[model samples]
Target: MSLKITDECINCDVCEPECPNGAISQGPDIYVIDPNMCTECVGHYDTPQCMEVCPVDCIITGVEESREVLEERYRIISGQKVA
Candidate 1:
C-alpha cells in the first residue's frame, strides 16, 4: 500500500527527500505522495522511507493493497510490466 501524509504533517519538507520513488511532493499545506509512483519502497528499501523520516509521524500506510495490486500499480506508474 502507498503511504499518505496526514494533516499532522508540519510542512517541514523532511519527508520529501526520503522517498526513493520521488512520490513525495510539496503540496498546498503538506507533503503529498503519488500512490501511482509509490511502491512503499518495496523494490528500493526495507521500509517506507517517508514514514521513517517524518518527524511528526504524519506518514501512514494506506489501505493495504495486495502485492499483485501493488505490482500492477507500479507497472502502470513505471510504464513496464513485470514478467
Candidate 2:
C-alpha cells in the first residue's frame, strides 16, 4: 500500500525528496501522498523511502494494496507497460 502523511507531520520538508515515485507533495496543512502514483518504492527500493526519512513518523501506510497491484501501479507510473 501507499503511505499518507498525518496531522502529526512537522512539515520538515524531508519526505518529498525521499519519495522515488514523486508521490509526496506539500498540501494545505502538511505533506500529502498521492495514492495513484505511490508504489511504496516497489520499483525503486525495498521499503518506502518517504517513511524512512520522515522525522515525525507521520508517514503511514494506507489503502492496503497487494504487492502485485503495487508493482503494476509502479510499472504504469514508470511507463514500463505497453498498451
For candidate 1, the per-residue lDDT at 63 reads 74
Candidate 2 segments whose C-alpha is farther than 4 A from its true place: none
- lDDT values for all models: 0.80, 0.86
Per-residue lDDT of 83 in model 2 = 41
Can you give the lDDT of residue 32 in candidate 2?
88
Best by TM-score: 2
Query: Where does model 1 exceed 4 Å of error?
Result: 75-81
> Could you tell me which residue pairs clash in candidate 2?
none
Q: Candidate 2, residue 63: CA error in Å?
A: 1.4
Q: What is the C-alpha local distance difference test score of candidate 2? A: 0.86
Query: Residue by residue across 1-83, what tens digits does model 2's lDDT show?
Result: 46778899999998899888888889998888989999999989988888888777888877788989899998899999734
Poorest 10 consecutive residues of model 2 by lDDT? 74-83
